[model samples]
Target: MIRDWEKILLVYEQAVEELKIKFKSIRKEYRNTDEYSPIEFVTGRVKKISSIIEKAKKRNISIDSIEDGIEDIAGIRIMCQLVDDIHRVVSLIRDRDGKDLKIVEERDYINNMKESGYRSYHIIIKYPVHTAFGAKEILAEIQIRTLAMNFWATIEHSLNYKFKHNIPKDIKERLKTAADAAFLLDMEMSAIRDEIMDAQQIFQAKSTIVAKILRNIQYLYFSGKIEEIEDIRDRFFDLNEEGDINRLKEFNNYLEKLMDKYNIRKLI
Candidate 1:
């Protein structure tokens, strides 16, 4: 009979390798550009594999057959950056094509929560994993979450694990309140991200103009003496700070009038 620890270690290693292969295959099939967290999947599988091995030890079950009925962590949680992204990734996961890929169950905790719970997606998949000894079908769990949602869940999970699901009432209440706060935090961050991206685009547009003006001035400086190049430089600084396209166009028109009156193109 294999020792309990040996069985657990062997299964854990096998599961980890199989999960890596499975993730790679899915990623290629979906053409996913984002990075995935394999550590979360491995950690969860280890816990489940250990539990199953412990039970097998207790039952005096000597499994000569590789097909032992074990269903613990056949679920995977996939965390995404946004609610929309979560849905997109879920669609990809659902459409994965492989002989071993089978979706046994699915849960969208983000939408199905009783309270203001944060968002995450989960899938329970049964994939046939071949071990060193023989071919065995094992269930795997996948979970997906946004970064903020993941942070909250990790803390909550630690609390539950520490207390063995018998946490104090006050702590439990505080945890729920914290979960609510995390939900609000995600929404606030999403809004802030959109605002910042919009602002960045505006900055990029203005900076492009400023760069072109500066380069032109630099090029003209080497050729000949222009009295108003200093004025052009000053205008560049002004437009940079204003970041207004209309104001920049007006300034450009003024510079053009000055250049025409002075016949500055002949100098260039």
Candidate 2:
């Protein structure tokens, strides 16, 4: 029994870590192309032994059938900036269904929220894990939600734990109200989503330009171009103070040209 539990936990842990990396890489790909990533961040966890046992007991699963009956032993959560992004992420996962993981079921709680006011899109998947023994398929769950929804759900989860899943009627009612408010916030943010995305993109582009320029400057300093570095530093400070992204980008181009002239390998 102990060995069985250890193997189960190990596989679930591996699944969680791999899924987190995969989802995070998707976000990184969008950022690398200077595009707005729908996925703001990802988090994952493998259920603890105690929690698993408790959940299985609550669900009335036989101990022998726990592995197959209890989903969410491995969980991945993707948080988005807007509700629309949640659907996009869900679509993305759907697109990769056959090649990466096979979708077992989908629960659209965002459209049809739970009675407890939980709002998230749940995707149950069978993920293949290659271990020393061989490839084993395990059930994992992915939850997608907007930031506002995540906030409310987090608070509700805490309350549920505190109340042992029997939250008082009064608190439950308040939670439902708060859930609606959170969804309203998401709607308002979605209304201005374009503006927010544009602002974020500009900030990201500026930050990238600054990083590249600084890296080049560091290369110049190390290459014994002290005087040149001083002038470049002053110009950079002036351009930064001007707070013009275009000018900063122009200065960055000039630095690239200068580096080329000096036979300095471009520092990305």
Candidate 3:
């Protein structure tokens, strides 16, 4: 057994790294398709040494029981744009196709906002980390919340830190009001969710097209005739400056037809 605190901390680090890698893979999988992904962004970290020690002392937990008493040593935060997205992410994590990840517990804090105005859905997962010793199962906490909720939680957390987790009554009431405002904002955004998602998808797809165009143009500058390259480049600039997505789409179509002439593979 790894009795050294340093080694145990490294194990926690390994667990966080593994979970981050897996979550990033899920994000990539969604971006490859036309579907809207619930995960806006993912971040993770292992509890700091001093913080771990403080938590253990506060909970009256022995060093040996730290893993059981302090469940958030390995933490991952997933931010979504909508409240529904938060739940979708939770389900996705639970039903995620993987053998190395498993949900051990869940806390629906979003529906049961804390008195401090904190709201987020937390899931405790068991992640298997491979080390020199062998495969070790480590518990990790995953917090899913809307971007607005995250924004409020961030500010409230800062206030709590400055006040030692005990803000004045007035400040606490104001924080609760701010939390309500954030909740309303999320609801307003979710009302037009489909429209926003469509626009975002179109914008992203256009960006991908632009990137592909630039790469192909750069490639052909050396491989193809300068005259043809310059003409295509001019057209690209004209279409871009017009700020017309339809024109851009048409340009992509043109590129597809001309791929044979330039001996270029399909861009999209």
Candidate 4:
């Protein structure tokens, strides 16, 4: 194993990038098909070298065993809009067909939360890192949680940092209460999940259609098709007012055809 921390970090960077891309690709697949995606957003990071060394020291891990002992040097966080979506995201990750991406372990704290009142699902995966020496298996972590849980956890993290991880008893009790409140909020949201999802889907569809129309109009305007712009805009306003997605789609297709009929001189 190489002792160069920079080279090791490059591998972590690649692992983070690959996982983020995979998760985002799944999100795109759902969005393109007009379906609900469990993934609200995906983010990743490589743990700081200082944090790594401290954790390793605490665990009494020797330098040679750091690669296997520290699983979260490369980390990914997946956020969801609802609690149920957390499980869905986990399933998606587990079903991934990558020959290199293999789930090694999962720690479910949501069902049986931590004594500190933390609630999240942790996933550890073995990812193959290709180097000049050949492919080597590296461990990475994926954390999944709802938006509300994230808010609570983020605040607790900040407080822990502020007090050097020795939070006062009163503050700890209050944090426990806040975690309960966050859980209640997630449960309430789950109660109206269907309605919320339906509204979100409608909004996404409308936004996508409007964006397409505006893009086509911009191209048409650049192509000296200003004459078509005003009429399309008027119709767009009418259909949007009526919430007519079918008509909006038709208008988008019509505009695309008009934009394609640019047989005139190039403005640029």
Model 3 clash number: 0
Model 2 stretches with alpha carbons more than 4 Å out: 1-3, 266-268
Weakest lDDT window of 10 consecutive positions for candidate 1: 33-42
Q: What lDDT score goes with residue 152 in model 1?
A: 85
lDDT of 3: 0.83
Please give, for residues 175-205, the per-residue lDDT of candidate 3 as tens digits: 9999999999999999999998898777767
lDDT of 2 at 147: 88
Encode model 2's per-residue lDDT on 14-128: one tens digit a residue.
8899999999999999987788899999999988888989988989987888889988999999999999899899999999999989999999999999998889999999999
Q: List the residue pairs that clash in candidate 4.
A: none
How do all models score by TM-score?
0.54, 0.96, 0.91, 0.89
- Each model's lDDT: 0.61, 0.90, 0.83, 0.87
Best by lDDT: 2
Global lDDT of model 1: 0.61
Local accuracy of candidate 1 as per-residue lDDT tens digits, 51-97: 55565576665553222444443334444445555666667667873
Say which prediction, candidate 1 or candidate 2, comes out ahead on TM-score: 2
By TM-score: ranked, best first: 2, 3, 4, 1
- In every candidate, how many clashes are there? 18, 0, 0, 0
Badly placed stretches (over 4 Å) of model 3 are 1-3, 262-268
| Clashing residue pairs found in predicted model 2 | none
Pairs in steric clash, model 3: none
